[model samples]
Target: MSPEFYTISQVADILSVSKETLRRWDNNGTLIPERDDGNNYRLYHKSQLEQFEQAQLLFQSNWNDELNIKASRPYKMLELFAGAGGLALGMEKAGLESVLLNELDKHACNTLRENRPDWNVVEGDISNIDFSEYHNEIDVLTGGFPCQAFSYAGKKLGFEDTRGTLFFEFARAVKETNPKVFLAENVRGLLNHEDGRTLETICDVIDDLGYKLVNPRVLKAIFYQVPQKRERLFLVGIRKDLISNSEFDWPSPYHRIMTMKDALKAGELYDCDVPNSEGQKYPKRKAEILAKVPQGGYWRDLPDDLQREYMMKSYFLGGGKTGMARRLSWDEPSLTLTCSPAQKQTERCHPEETRPLTVREYARIQTFPDNWKFSGPISAQYKQIGNAVPVNLAFAVGRSIIKTLNIIEKNTAMNKKKCA
Candidate 1:
């Protein structure tokens, strides 16, 4: 059967143009289509549009940097706090091998093990794990260690001062493994956490561990094929010896944004619609109220009386109160996925459903493949998926890391030849 019809509005979005422009193009006979049903809604057959170079560009350019990675050796990776394996999986997809992945959460660990039984899923506190065994064997150490305030008692905090924080454990592993490169990730808030002293201290610790820190940058997920506006600060370090010889390039952003529709439907991100799976439900009255919200609309869109009734004292508060009753739009990247979809402070209601997004929906928004199943109860699954890095974004970063490794390896070989 032919694909389902898309309205002019949908076509405009797929082309990243306005509906009026699409209409103008239609009137001028620049863009025409075949008929569909009785309603006479201008239906463009998916096949008729295939010859358009722009459409081909959209398809060809989808996740650009991810598709064009330079050739590099298959470097081994040891990941710490590897939640749900998003970064690890993306790196693996980019050709890095996950020699070991450590996570404290049983559910996340189980999910990792269930998906890839071959992975060395180390389920425990990273502080207790001895990474020294992987020394010289692993080429990269990566993690999303939780951001914590450093005990900045002196001019420069050293590795010992970082003890007691998970980042310290990450550092200790870097020290133990002495990998050629390391990449640490965290929320964008880390840039200003404790008024920036925390990050300065992190840089200091990486330096103490004999690695030269790259000027860390926070990358927007929406620009990297993640259908969400989540921003993460990436801290990259190269062993000081390699930094002198190898040039590093951060991944370039894609020209397009992957939106909610791209995530849930079969257009770009996946081959089919998001799978039906478990999701959080709103209370009856709340769901009834939220049903009135238009796609892309939020609580402020509610009727005056309903707004007062639902929001109570919050109605009088200062900010836009946006997330309170937000409905997602198909054409825009979703707001950052939170740990819980239906939380009062950070609601992510489904585009069509009155309830919160399902675990599978959340996973798709994060660019997880459909076959990659999550373990544990429904709630636990949601948490694991929600907390993950978007796999596509990770892949883009992974390609950059691989490029850095290639340069380093090539320089090392050239140096050996010179000595010989």
Candidate 2:
């Protein structure tokens, strides 16, 4: 069965509200929590949370229903930076055909080839590839290009001004392919990068390349059925000619919040418990110190002496530093997975066990299916999975893109008949 109670911190994270706000609500009698007898800690009941609009989505019977949005006709896609096939797999699940997938990492390309032997996985530098062959043929072009700062060499940044950056390559592909729509994903920090000029420049470049940019949005993965609290910024652009005919909408959030329980157990997300896989281990001293941390607790929960011993001079520094020495709670979504689970600064120790989460567990948290095999050494495997867009989240976005295309296709068919 699912959890019946949640701590204040858990509730705050789930509702995307600050702890201070939760306390204010409690004081105002807007949303009160029950007090624990042992320590008098505030605990919120699942039933009480249902009173909230965000929480109410979880209780609706149709919350997890698949939109099953399908392509009205044959639609092909060309994917760039196809890391470990996370986005490609999700788009494939959404019924889009993968015409080509390009990646620089050999391990990722191998993983893609091993999993989907039929896919045309191009393994090389993206700068060397010619995308013009697919021009006006492919339906969509998608990628998560790495963000790089643009040189302030010009007053008004245009397509040519962004020539050296990875985003430029993404834009160049969009220009060459001239797909009906293109999607780009990046870290949430991109929204405010370089005081927002970076994003403004990107928008200007998209316009220069003959596309209409949609209002970019930062989507929370937890809201879309993934069990991690990851946020990604998405930019969708349509061809100038098709912009007037297409209507795009963001995907709806899942009905209920999924916890670590759902990711690891045979619940809604997976049919079986998380499979055992290789993972990094804590050193003897580190393991001994972390064992004292309770579920949902972090470095602050340690005794004063141990805190100093573990943290050293850094403990004296300011900032919450909550990710340090942290243990995840079973009833709440896991903190965003990092490239290294056992990193000293961002530890993701198991809720009950003292060790770090294994590879399969990490994949499960990212909503990668159990059968999806990642190729490479342990470190490379972690890097690939950690760097991936959550599959379910991508699937949700892909469905929205498909919906827009469906509308555009219908309108085009009607116009062709009228012209005839």
Model 2, CA-based lDDT: 0.91
lDDT of each: 0.84, 0.91
Model 1 earns a TM-score of: 0.85
Q: How big is the RMSD of model 1?
A: 6.7
lDDT of 2 by residue, 1-420 (tens): 236887887688668898889999999999999998889989999999887776765556343454767889878999999999889988888879999999999999999999999999999999899999998899999999998899986598989889889999999999899999999999999999999999999999999899998999998898889989999999999999997788998887876678899999998899999998999999999999999999989999999999999999889999989999999989788999999999989999999999999999999999999999999999999999999999999998988889899999999888899999
Q: Which has the greatest TM-score?
A: 2
Candidate 1 clashes between residue pairs 3 or more apart in a chain or in different chains: none
Error of 1 at 418 (Å): 1.1
List model 1 lDDT by residue over 1-420, tens digit each: 134445665466456567678778888998875555676767776565567664555446535544777656678999999989999998998879999999999999999999999999999988788888888888889999998887777678888887899888988999899999999999999999999899989988888888998899988787677888788999999999888778777776665567899999998679998889878899999999999999988888999999998889998989877788888998677888988889877889999878899888999999999999999998888889888988988998998888888889888999999999
